[model samples]
Target: MHGFCMLNCFLSRPDEVTFTAQFDRPGNIGRVHIGKAEIEGYKSKVGSVITSRDFITNSKGGPTWRLKFEICTFPLKGKVRFAFSDSTADARDFDDAIITQQETVRATPEGHENMPENLNNLAIVLLQRFKRTGNLSDIDAAISAFKQAIHLTDEDGLFMPLYLNNLGNAFLARYDRTGDTNDIMASISAYRESKCFDHTSNPFYIQTAIFCYSRPATDYDGYPDDRLVAAQYWVGLSQQHDPSQVLAAYSTAISLVSQVASLSQTIQARYRSLLKVSRLSTSAATVALGLERIDLALEWLERGRGLVWNQLNDLRTPIQVMKPSGADYPPANITEELERVSKALDRAGASRELWLAPSAGTSFTDVRALPGFEGFLKPLIHADMIDHLPASGHVVIINVHEDRCDALALRRGVHELCRISLPDFSYTKAEGLRESLKLYLHASGARTRGDWNATRGMRREGGSGGVVKNILRDLWILVVKPILNPGLCGESKSLTLPEFAISSYIPTFQTLVDRVKKPRKVEPENAGIFMISQPGTPNQSPIPKPERNAAATVNRVINIMENYTCVHFACHANQNTSDALKSGFALYDGQLDLSSIIQKQLVGAELAFLSACQTSTGDESLAEEAVHLAAGMLAAGYRSVVATMWSIQDQYGPKVAEGFYASLIDSESEGLNADGASRALHYAIQNLRKSLGDSESSLVSWVPYVHFGV
Candidate 1:
């Protein structure tokens, strides 16, 4: 109720983009320092200028690694500086940033003129700083502020991506700091942001996405869901924009080819290619055999498989290996199926040959095992390969909750059969499949605990203090996910998309209604007042309206069950007992006593549309009392109760109900729910929107119409 509405993004770009890089051979120059780590070169058969690390680092130190930038033949007209043009903060903050290097520091540039490509280097320089010191504040500030810099410099310029790449680094650093789930979400959310309608490749955007989504932490809320969602995003974007876009070219690098192959499989199958299914099974086999806790090993192994099957599906053999001094071992199992699964990938008219990365500092190679490796693909490894991915598989250290549990074994045997039928999948170690996925059998929601309070003269005779929001959220999530990301859904499990899931489209379409708003408040004196047991509240003032406050207009309240046609109720009614449920309704006053007037109302109504409480039996006897669940509501004139077994939020409940009503009413208007058409004029569901925006009454009085039916 107190949350801010997240502004829905409403741009209409046709889901893809084109990219063009600045250099003919864009790549990592690598550790090109000679003997004393000092490499010097001069112009030979080229129009280019030289920039030494000493000039950039301002070291004047022992040695420097230098780069030779080929000058623009037609005209080397302008300068490209790495330094950002705007920073409100002092230089000390930049100096204070953490940095790491194997040995010997690069000399720093003394002034702005002496530096080059600072916009592209800011992120890396800060990254180097963070890697060395582990302080997050500096990096966090940079991330928050860098967006301004990105907008300022990268506007259709020739070397914009040079700046965009550094900006991407800032975001990545921020993600690394918070592990704040939504932060990760926001970080990757803007990866493909458009600058101009031109052919420009933002590899940094894709690269950052791979990092934020792949090797995430456990405590981060909804990690797997976020990561999986992130994958679909980039994969779809890549396919839509440029399917063959690899981190680097692979035509000449066999290992790089394997890495790109892994990349291909992930996107082609829509993240389904199971590169290491056998290996995952074998590792889980170890766990089943009561072997050592292989969680960490499994995590590495699963990720390795995903990298092979989901991310890189081109090259076979190996990309890069981990070895200390002299080590001997069998090649990783997951890497074996890269070339095979990649066959299923859809050709987005892109190739997997152009991939690149730095040497990432590998001491030696084990190519002695390969002779038939004559593939035309190439590969490269970067120094910072989004560490912790470990070249290991995911399942090894996969969290329990992300995986489904044995709940599928209860009642419906689909999951039980699914495991055996799909032996390739693994078992889940989690408990409940999110309370949201959990349905309350007969009730729309579950009660918090065993006890419930009853208020006199109130519609909700039995209401509890149970919390059901999380469960409902889970339900909405499960129902909406498949529709939002069908490819991911198809790969993970066999759940079909629920197009009816309201929340899924609500963001994209603001018209996703929740509850049918109530009618305007008229003088209560103008409405018909009722009583029960022949003797209710002495003067018959109607216990302060069922909502909040003393002066409710009560103009457009729900009619008696016999009052309107069922078509008018819409989703406001619980799906139980014909959707005319009046469950979970209670006194906004929060008291716990049976309201006699409410009891009599239920006694007369044919359909017990209780979106209110959760007591099955009555005070006296289940069948004898007018408030009993099964018999009383049925005996009273009502056919059923769309009630809650637990208490739900008054905040979004009405909105959800409003949406349900809209859907229902929309369907009924077209003859879907024939019985819903019977509702009379004013109190009909069609008037909900009009009723909610009634500017006459204070907001509180109109806030308590959460229902339990239909």
Candidate 2:
């Protein structure tokens, strides 16, 4: 039986070396010989044999191996030669030859200094060997070799970052064994300093720096403050580069933040850590604001908040959107044969994570090169975007920070951005309120599974947590009422009521009950019923045929979304903590997830009323970041969104729905547009308060409703 053969050569001396010969052939006894070199124990039955420095092949099978080996001293001019019988053997022999050449040159100080490239190459191989065998000596050798190479290279040369990155990696490996913090610190410093060099043109070097900073020894189990500082540093370094580098940096920083959350022993601690890291959004916002670009600022805020999931879902966009355009096309198109190849290169260069597939192009150069893609993915400028809002409503942007909160109010007719001070509002206070709300709702039996019909019109405020009521009052007085201003809400004919569009997806309650009872789909009488009405023409509204699953809901919406001016979804919402972007509506058959809604990028989606539980709530760790369905819809191109901050009672769902649509339809009939959503919701909540006849219960029913987008 024919089997394969392999040869390995070890260069122990500048003038002489040794070779090891091995074969895959079992029990085949063969003596190996080279021109002037002969294997010791040449007659052994074993497949491997060692040979002296001078090597040549002599076997019964003519020209058995094609590998050509030549050992030269001094100027290293001549190449020793013998051809391998197979191409595979040829490639192996060629690689071995280079290794031998590098080892010989490294034998002398003069030779090492004269060829820095050779030294760098040898260092990479040694580091790889260290990885394979976990040999400390190999890593040490790699460090010494890379240091020499770095010293010999010019400061401005392209190879400098490569050399420095490799040296840093070698030190990190040694630090792991010796527990020497100094070694790790030195590695981080080297990596940070190397970024100053013009290595932006090289993808691998950029990735190397990111890897070094992200994997610093100080990051592992460090104090919360220390880890945060390290994460900040990573994000800072990431911002100094192009869009691709920024994405990579934030991706790693998000992981670090998640790790911080996981390391916490309590939910409160985790929330606090998340609050601190919320600086991620503020920092990105600061940069975007400096550019005088509100659209980019919004994108930065959204992307910075939901870093991990955003990056994962970012890549899932269309390849046409990912195609290289501007400056990248002339060079990139020639270099990368296919758009897929360009995408592959993009994934290779910018991704910090290996677990998920790359969906978005991170290369800033590539991003800017695409037509109309400047300022990072066709930003929706403040002017153009606000046009989609209702004339009767004001757009309030609440910026939450550590020191304070600022609410910026903009209306369709207003030219100036009005700043409102929220001196009493704070993140800590908001969190406390949230906790109180959760406790109150749980104690009140609001979220419990039951026939909500049986409990209709009943006052269920047993746990009457007064804190939530006070918080709502403060929100109305401080956040909402102040933003509405004195003259904005006047009965002005110029500011007509906003148009209305409504779509409700509700799996039959009986089906929901039966499924929960048996953990499977229930073929009940009315399984997948959707209720939709033509805005301003609700009298002629029709209830569509019952669809079977989530896909049907998605497809139905896709068919009707363009027909309606503003859209609303009244369904069950689930906020997926494990993967926030996958969080979505629980419909028949499946989930109408964030990914689907976002990917749609609806063109004329003016307003979205997500009358679902926790529509505005996201993972606490990403509190400052907009990782909720509302933000997802905004990013998906909706101008304004009405969502819930927390779950509301099932009974109130109908009241809120009926009140919102009636107001919206009336306003639109008079030409106000849909901007009345916020005001309508406010009035609806007020009406609910009147009906409840108590502050505490009303807060439970209405406080969860919040506005997003414009």
Candidate 3:
């Protein structure tokens, strides 16, 4: 019924903090003092009595709370270092140069080749030493070591990923060393590349380590409250992963143990008794102290799971059938502990969504600073009206929804679009849409859980559509309008409809526009004409496939333009937006589509960077999202497009679109074809990207900027 209690001795609060001893350890170093800083290790083996952490060098996890605490407080003082055994570079490798074998597919690598997993473990030990001795040189050395690891450039795929992952650890160490955004992003990218290489399709396991490694430190740079939040986040995140491996990592990397100074039997016994008494009298003995060592806590909890499983009234037999694998994972003492670990891991594994949900240590600054932060949000688009933009001086349109909503699964979101609409008290981004959706769902006989979390998994049958609507409503009101231009929100019927870009792809006018009349050696003017998406380096020795396409297209189009500068981009479009739909105007061999069919691949553009919808949409709105298409011509040197807000129907696209190009050309000078077209097209797309709040912006199909050049 109750949990096994341990004497938790940690710096919970300054001045009033209490310290107690659990027992004496191997090679007792000295007499116990209440407050002097100490260095020790925690050991699972009995009678070893923890001494130095290096006892287990091959394994790089457990705890270093005391050391981390010191680093967090005076971050400028600590540093980290690393040494790699292998490194490489290979062009055939679609994987970043990182590799690691993991326990599951969801947490494993997705590509054939891998980049090194970034890390810097040795530097961590030195950092702890710096904390104790205040050695500036140590910090500098750690920084240098990590940077060297990051810039490791050998074009051959010959290095080991373990070392690469450790290089990532350097970023973790630096972030702890300094609460700088660059370090966090660098760390995130290193890990992401790791996923691209390894065979596992999942990216969660690496994310877990990154999260813990970057956890805010207590009294970090002199912020005690921040330290508390950091610790809480760590515990929450550590517990969120599966028990088999995640727990071990939490134990190895996060917890720090101090030696009890091996004592005689009488002294050791007395120490234990004293610690127990202190637990009752001091606040430091509360759960939070032990909470930091969640791995150990989880170990204890697993024991408790036995009884807890039986206690569950609606438990299934299959779940109970899952037994501990051999002696390596024996049953634990408490049933509830098992329940806790199991629940946390299940939730973590089940929810693949990278959320905007409140994490204990999360902030906008940290999130935005993460590498590819902007790219991450591209996947969540819902409705886009940028292409067929309707113009209203000011408007507020609301669709109450055909049915009521489930009050239990979601919350209302509200935000003022920066330049789009006037500030209305009741109108909000996600909140208003959520409200209408809930009402509609309720009318339609939807159910609810006590409290709600908007994960896609926890929705009713008709829930997703309504949810998407609200999300679109929110996306328009909050993110899109503010991003495109908030001024539009002031005069228009502020309501925006939904469009799922999942149906297609679209190309740019450049695909339709004429190319140079002839082809020749590289010229400076051609720079803006096409950009190559070489991996590793911006300008590599080999031109990419996209660039090759650009060359071929420019050659053909230029010949046509020389005779008659009039043409239309003939291609397919889909229902997806941004990268999903593959945007930017491009031209690919028509036979390429046939190849996709033969190969059984998702046939499309080389870089569907920013797409709104596919040309494949149904001829009419009767099927709603039923008919959608994709469009784009493939070209060499180009990767994708950074496009408009969201989905846009086909009919309205060319109309509002025409206005964009006209405005663009008006801004350019005569005789400057390259400059004029580039600038003009960008202007047109950006203009169309804005929602004027007219009937045009609400077509509810695909939308995105098309990129097609050299």
Candidate 4:
């Protein structure tokens, strides 16, 4: 009784000792009195102890005395012992001395006797069974299991929301198969309720809410306005979080719409949904604008219409920096990096991550941070472009919205920006005008004088080519003319169209003529050769014949392009919608795509004449985006661009080129400047019109050739 025992226990006990004793007799159990208790190593005295009733163990075959104690030492270890009756007669070991901690256990829900024990497993099995057997009963069983799991889960637990979400999804499936409104409504309610318990910042749940609310709310046919209220509610929920999430959600939604619109393929596939989402963006901006939130309006516009510009900006950066110069070549590493960036941007429409810079508001910082990217192109904001507008010329932006349209106009020297209301210009009218332009061009190209019936079919009063004229006239009157008029500044102005004029500022440019042809000797495959024998001439190479075809030929066009002011491409042009950056002119030794053109800063380039086929045909999927070659050139810094909408007659390319350059060189008296190009193009087309004698074929010859930019 006087001896002490050392024991190891799981409990973290204080060093102060509290001893409990138990004594057992056949008739009764009573507390045992301990003389004294002391922890062997600790100085703290024992506290008072409470004893339990006598417990009998079968191993000992006798009643036993059990004792427990605590000491004030921090290690939570102390000595304790149990004394058993008849211990000396037949010694037996007591295994109950050791106290072990028990872990908390979660209850797993089971299916029926023939099913899985785990609720998740059972739910999955039922879902699969329903899919395989086409039985609604299995889905109902799964839904029930999910609900059971949800109920058993703590209300604030992480798994609870997941269970609820699963239950809602199952309900949605049932609704889809059965066309039951109740099931869908229940599904929406379940999802909404589940959001209350979602404490984590995962955006997937937010995306789920958007999809859930959108189906019955905004996207569904004949859905009630109350559904829209729900959709707005969910959107509000998402907007409550970080703004980055909201931007990503809206960006993803727009991309999805773009994919759908692109898939429609037909020019006439003006999917109302695409228009609807775009109009929603307008509405969002309108609200922000109403609150005088111009910054927010600009953000909204950048998210939508500014999309293509941002993409092009990113695409242009590496190309401009990595472009080879005369006697200089891009190292293998630079070439590889350029190719990688190009591939990433090519698939940007499908990847939202690529669309955004690694850091917000900056474009291509990730790419620019790579080795050998010190001089990479920098990103630009809307204000930068606005500030770059010509002092004399007006920059007009026609914003087509759902309920109304407005024209935003700015000039370089003018401090005040003007907004003009265009009651006649609507989204529907814009689409109609686009369709009409396409239709007239397509139909007019399809027939000659021989096909009178086709001609007659297109000759309705406001139909055929009249639509094109009317659209141009409207654009001029409603959008353009108002911006040009001095009446906004209180200057008296006539309603008649002003004669197209320009300042007498003479801009000079280097004339390049690069057309690849077989040279006298093939170049060495390993020399990394990039040299020009003369300006505007095919570069001479000294590679061996068979190996020349095997070696990587460097493009000289990119090297020489930035050195000049007015560049003209008379080579074969190809458009790659799959990779718009790759859509470019086939130059000597290599191809110069729009990627290169846009990347290369052209502050020196006054005019660009892309005398190639279909130089201005943008990807139809990205029609709202200005992804065309002409636009790329303009974006590259060309104040004026002459591009073709479709393939022109091979013989006509040179004639138009000659006419264009001759007008620029010969018309000094006309005060030929940047604006003079547009007038020159108009007169050039007029000359072509005269040459072709005003026939439908003449329109075909001249119509494809058009002017863009200032």
Q: Provide the lDDT at 69 for model 4.
A: 15
* Candidate 3, poorest ten consecutive residues by summed lDDT: 76-85
Best by lDDT: 2
TM-score of 2: 0.45
**1-710 per-residue lDDT for model 4 (tens digits):** 21211111101232332333432231111111111111111112112111212122221142222111111110011111212111212111111111100000022113322111235444644554465455897788778877766666667764667778877888898898899999999999999988878665688876676667556444433122234345455456556753434443443343343333331122112222233344545555554454454544544554555244444444444554455532244455545555555545434233332222212223345445656654354323345445555546555555576666776555676656566667766778777777777776666543221123322333444334455556656766665555565554243333323244321210110000000010112122211112222112144212111212222223556766666556666555667654545677654566666656655554455667776667777765555444567766655566667888775654455567668767876664323234367767766776776787534445556767767754
Q: Candidate 1: worst 10 consecutive residues by lDDT?
A: 505-514
Tens-place lDDT digits, model 1, residues 1-710: 00001000100121221112332211111111110011111111011111222222232222322222211110111111101111223333335322211011233233322133332344455554564467786576455435534555536655555455555666666677667776566555444443333343687765665445333311122222233334444433443444353111111111221222233122222222222122332233232222232222222222322232122222211332212212333243323232232222212213342111111101112233434332212221211122212122110112122222111101121111111112222333112532322332124222331111122111121231122333333433443342243555554433422222211100000010111111122232332222111111223222212233321111223233223323111111111221112232222222212212132332123223333333332221111111223232332223223333333333333454445445445542332221231231113223443454422121111222222211
Q: What's the best-to-worst order under lDDT?
A: 2, 4, 3, 1
TM-score of each: 0.21, 0.45, 0.23, 0.48
Is 1 or 4 the stronger prediction by TM-score?
A: 4
Expressed as tens digits, the lDDT of each residue in 99-133 for candidate 2 is 65465454445633446766666676566556656
Better of 2 and 4 by TM-score: 4
Candidate 2 residues lying further than 4 Å off, grouped into runs, are 1-277, 283-394, 409-421, 449-465, 476-570, 597-611, 635-642, 669-676, 679-683, 707-710
Better of 1 and 2 by TM-score: 2
lDDT of 3 by residue, 1-710 (tens): 00101111211222332223432221111111101111111111111212222232113233453333222211111110011111112221101111111111123123312212222333444444444445566555555544443455343344435445554665666676677788788778777766555654356765655465445442233122233335434544445544333443333322211112111112122122223222111111112123343223322222111111111111111123223333223233222333343333222112221111112113222423444333221111111112111121221221111121111010112122112222332323335664654454344322221112221122343544545444555666544454333454554535442221111122321221112211223232322222222212212122212213333242353343222112233222233221111222333322122112111221121222222223322222112111122222222211222233333333344554466346534654432222233344455544554653222123222233333332
